[model samples]
Target: MTTSSEPRTEPRTEPHTELLRPDGSPVRVLVVDDESSLTELLSMALRYEGWEIRTAADGAGAVAAARAFRPDAVVLDVMLPDMHGLTVLGRLRRELPDVPVLFLTVKDAVEDRIAGLTAGGDDYVTKPFSLEEVVARLRGLIRRSGAAARRSESVLAVGDLTLDEDSHEVARGGDSIHLTATEFELLRYLMRNPRRVLSKAQILDRVWSYDFGGQANVVELYISYLRRKIDAGRSPMIHTRRGAGYLIKPAEAAAA
Candidate 1:
């Protein structure tokens, strides 16, 4: 489980490290936690990524800060003094439904994580997480949200697997597939490359940038994620090359 307190021996770089708001403003992030020390640590890490930070210690304060700061993203704690984290998020969603939120909590149970995500959390970092992972997850969420805001209107298609960059929507054979930010980007890279075998190192470098330390397992994990969503119960488009890399092509294309 990745948490914010995990120590890192080396620095990590994000693909959108220099990302700004659509309006050319610095990206803003609201950090909500009753723990002042934790908030400080999060703020420092986010600031290092060039994002403006707002801190809130309670549910009410979080809601007020969200209204005032209009952060591009939020790092919300599930437990609050005044209210439960989900309640606060429910309120925030009414005001800013499109804002991406990442949850922070000590609950490490599978069901607890599911509950948090089912509550509309874009992602979460459990207790004792590495700040690098937190930053990576945040970058992924913000990148996808920003892409949606920009509405680039770019579309990529490969053997019926289609992704609309502008709308942040993916579909396979008219069946909609909902994917997380990272998953979408990973698919986009695969779709762009089409049947070409892309090594784990290549995928990591291109999709996650060099900051993720070229973790091959991460690549494999996401590939399995994509396979489940886009290929299960359908003609498979993603193929593994054993010791080589992964490739995405139309099922028919592969046969041909």
Candidate 2:
């Protein structure tokens, strides 16, 4: 195993041992990676979130764990020793279609990131990642999943763009817009605050989490992602405010 040159802050030793679901059940998470130490560290941090965690060091073990533990979410490593991460993801999807997955990979290539998401991952975090960021991402995923399950609102709209929280659907001018969990959350935040300039810091805090200590560049990356999917080939609704931040508004409102 190769060691990262990046400085490692000592991982928080104490776990949040009492985390539980709304019904008083523990939030279950399966951590999959060949690196035992990394999995141990992640398990500790996630247990801090009051989640019950099960660990798997290889792809087959990951699938088995997911099936037996019935986790609400999965933190998966891309390069597993026994099988590829996406292969494991495929098996997990077959068993638990709606369970949100966050992919962890060492590569930062665009194609690799796209492939992971295209394969049904809800979010991607590159390695050398902060445990705080992982926890924040998991929190966001679980929160959104819970919201989608419980939301009473039928729809949210800012002009022609519409998002149905209960249905887990989005559309613009009658054209369906497919979105991953993270994209849906980010757009939901923007639509909830239509026309208001949201700094990257604010977006990160709300859409990601206040606990996420990762770089602000991830905000920029996902914003571009939203533009391509939501605004492409149409009158643009997502606007960059240069150094100020970003905003989503009706096209006419932006032109005004």
Error of 1 at 196 (Å): 43
Off by over 4 Å in 2: 1-19, 147-256
Per-residue lDDT over 107-140 for candidate 1, one digit per residue giving the tens place of the 0 to 100 score:
7899999998999989988876677778888878
C-alpha positional error of residue 212 in candidate 1 after TM-score superposition, expressed in Å: 37
Error of 2 at 209 (Å): 31
Judge candidate 1 at residue 127 and give its lDDT.
Answer: 75
| TM accuracy, model 1 | 0.54
Global lDDT of each model? 0.80, 0.80
Clash counts per candidate, in order, are 2, 2
Task: Write out the backbone clash pairs for model 1.
Answer: 2-129, 3-129
lDDT of 2 by residue, 1-256 (tens): 5446221345554332222354434478999988888888888777545456899999999888988999999999999998999999999999999999999988889999999999999999887878888887887888777722222345556667778878879998889999999999999888766667889989998888875666899999999999999889888989999899998866654455
Pick the TM-score winner. Answer: 1
